[model samples]
Target chain A: GDQVKQSPSALSLQEGTNSALRCNFSIATTTVQWFLQNPRGSLMNLFYLVPGTKENGRLKSTFNSKESYSTLHIRDAQLEDSGTYFCAAEAPQGGRALIFGTGTTVSVSP
Target chain B: EAAVTQSPRNKVAVTGGKVTLSCNQTNNHNNMYWYRQDTGHGLRLIHYSYGAGSTEKGDIPDGYKASRPSQENFSLILELATPSQTSVYFCASGESQSQNTLYFGAGTRLSVL
Candidate 1:
């Protein structure tokens, strides 16, 4: 079973629009991290949350430990926002390794 | 920034051939992990190590092998590559569970033809 399930396997957004990506966890996760795999396939950490919200530039993320879910919101999306978004969770009871999602591919065009 | 780099960013090998992917991290991390990503499986853990000279099996470790010869380097080896083994492999390093923020490498794309 997947520990983290990402929603809307794929999405397309127009420039200047906004969209949100969600992840629902089945495992008892304590922390969640959102990452962006850019065009070159280089991954960049967007947010690391523990039952809270954090915003950076045009990106924001929230993690709910009780509900076992996390969300990444993209505001004022741009062409550079087109990439694959992944959510990974870390459980307190287990190893330090993260369980990653299948990923949500986003294409932001003009 | 914590720098993690993977060598041989792209590889092409024939079936039954041996291939090795290497990762290096500048951050003195206590844990290192190897994962493979496919269209269906997302990212499945193959192997991990707590520190130098230690390796542990992960969710999927049958077809792969991992070695952590030193604190800064970890390698994933495919002794007998198969077509099904073609995927993007990523390496991540973390300090510990409490401060377990992973620093990921650029990833290695392997194709077993």
Candidate 2:
């Protein structure tokens, strides 16, 4: 079974608009991390959460371990924000590795 | 900034050939991991290590092996490459704690013919 599920397989938004990505986990996860795979194919870490909310400039994220879900909110989207967003969760049963979601492909156009 | 570098950004191998992908991290993190990315499957863990001389299998470890001889280096090996194994491989390093953030490499694109 798929332990992690991501929403909105794909999305497109205007440069100045806002959007949110989500992930649902069936496993008992201890932590969650969000990553942005840029146009160059580089996976850049965006946030690491522990059942709380975190904000980084125009990006914000929240994790609810009890509910087994996480969300990433992007504000004032820019052209540079066009990329694939992935969420990974760490669980004791899953070992030291983090289980990842299928990811959401986001396109922020002018 | 944490730096994780992977060697051979791109590779091409024939069927049944051996392939080795190397990763080096300057962060000196205790945990290192290898994952593969396919078109529909975002990322799947293959192998990981907790420290030097300790390697563990992840969700999808069959037909693959991992080596962690030192704190800064980890390698993923494919003894008999297959076309199905062709994908973008990424290496990452993080602190031992689950809450710690992970730093990833640019990834290596491998093509097995």
User: Residues A1-110, candidate 1, lDDT per residue (tens digit)?
Assistant: 37789998999999999999999999887788888889898888878788989999999898988888899999999999999999998744345778889999999989
Docking class of 1: medium
**Model 1, residue B41: displacement in angstroms?**
2.2
Of the candidates shown, which would achieve the greatest lDDT relative to the real structure? 2
Residues B9-107 of candidate 1: C-alpha lDDT, one tens digit per residue: 999999999999999998999899998888866788899999999998888899899999999999999999999999999999988756578888999
Specify the highest-DockQ model's number.
2
**In lDDT terms, how accurate is model 2?**
0.92
Candidate 2, clashing residue pairs?
A: none
TM-score of chain A of each: 0.94, 0.95
- What DockQ does candidate 2 score? 0.73
DockQ of each: 0.64, 0.73
TM-score of 1: 0.95
